[model samples]
Target: MTSPASPYVGRFAPSPSGPLHLGSVVAALASWLDARAHGGRWLVRMEDVDGPRTVPGADQVILAQLAALGMTSDDDVIYQSSRHAVYEAALARLTAMGLIYPCGCTRREIADSAPIHAVSGERPYPGTCRTGLQPGRGPRAWRVRMPAGVHCFEDRWLGRQCQDVAREVGDIVLRRADGQWAYQLAVVIDDADQGVTDIVRGADLLSSTARQQVLGQTLGLPLPRVMHVPLIVDTDGRKLSKQNGAPAVDTQAPLVALQAAWTALGFAPLPDASTAAAFLTQATDAWRLRWHIHPCSA
Candidate 1:
């Protein structure tokens, strides 16, 4: 049977490791624009999965920034740290399906493995723990066993992509060696739980989309539309990040920042578009036109 009708639900899930920098502002603004333009309800989720990394009061500051920029979500904010039970349930489901197993490979162990694959131009897991050791071992992490075969999906922007998760991703950790839940596991569960119909974010995360799609299938959740817009970079051409020390937006100049964001996507903003609503309307038309000219190759 075909999937249910896609809901008009969109979301912006950001981590609270630090303030919402310029790159984050672009992502938030873009998600907000697309949701509002379609008359959809946008929701905000605080991805505080790594408790050790999150800063106190960062979530409130992020929410405040959205409000100051005139981007309002439809529901109360969801914090990942507060949803441990939900993650436990999902982990139980995967465990029951025999898709999850204990992984004892550390970073050093993985790096020393013979066969490996590179992701995002860095270290890819070598599947050292895929089929190793007993289940109840001490201080082991949980990994989702990836199935063999080519997995593919058509991104709304990046076009058709195919990857063999078993080969490329290997057995990825669901729970960390440090007892922290992995991002891949948490994100898949959160998206399904939130009823997210679409995901729009920076191009930097494009590589993870394929693995997420596989996780969605295993969890019996609909594969949402994926769109990865251009990521903002620093003078050195490095992607702006919290570690890069990128400054957060002033919120008072959201319109200007929004304009820059649209421009980075290779779209032109309207001259008189001062308000958030007005800028979003123009951004929508620009996106449609761009997609029309260069449709997704999927």
Candidate 2:
């Protein structure tokens, strides 16, 4: 007899710096719906990794909001702060494989070293610290050596896309100079260790998926399939975000928020589906039918 399949597991990892706004709600809803549709386990990762950026009581607020929205995650929340040992272990593995190195170059120094790429929206590191500074150097920030050649992937929502990691992203940081964990490192370790099967989030993270896939391959971690839905933007055409002051959705009216999210994703609203669970059921079916429907980005 064939072995039983690994159950589908998806997650909505939100940084607990503030309340869940429209865009966040959209992400949680999509991930939850996707997991439900596939009879999968949906988990939540409280990304309190960046302690400096975390707001007080934000974690509780986020959980309460998700509960109010009727988004039931499978396990008790997994906080990133508690997983440093796991991240350290992964980093050690990469170090053993000679995939990571210390970098002394600061942001200002990098900017001064090379012409920053304006298109990537972030200054691409110029490998100033790729080579070691003398032999017996002490601990400094760590950088992952991105593999060369074209890294390509078929996005579940955005079709065949490719990028040269060496050119586009350059060497990404695994650990920051300030001793905090980088998002790239933390997220990859968490997903792999947690056995996350799939990732469902907003389109804004589309490009980052490629980098995560590359990291996964290097570290021999299972690469989860990604589903990037369009972001919820304000009237200003800006994606609703905490930085933009997007108010958190009222958890009291979860069905209303769910319906709005479904409609935003181009799903036709059900006529009499009035409850949150019912809307989720209908929305998931609609979403599954539209899975891997890539956006035309020519």
Cα lDDT of model 1 by residue, 78-158, tens digit = 999988898889999999998887777667777777344554354566666567664655546888887788888777777
What number of clashing residue pairs does each candidate have, in the order they appear? 0, 1
Model 2 bad stretches (over 4 Å): 1-5, 116-121, 134-140, 292-298
Residue 125 of model 1 has an lDDT of 69
lDDT of 2 by residue, 50-95 (tens): 9898999998899888888778679988999999888889899999
lDDT of 1 at 189: 87
CA lDDT of every candidate: 0.78, 0.81
Off by over 4 Å in 1: 1-4, 114-122, 134-137, 288-298
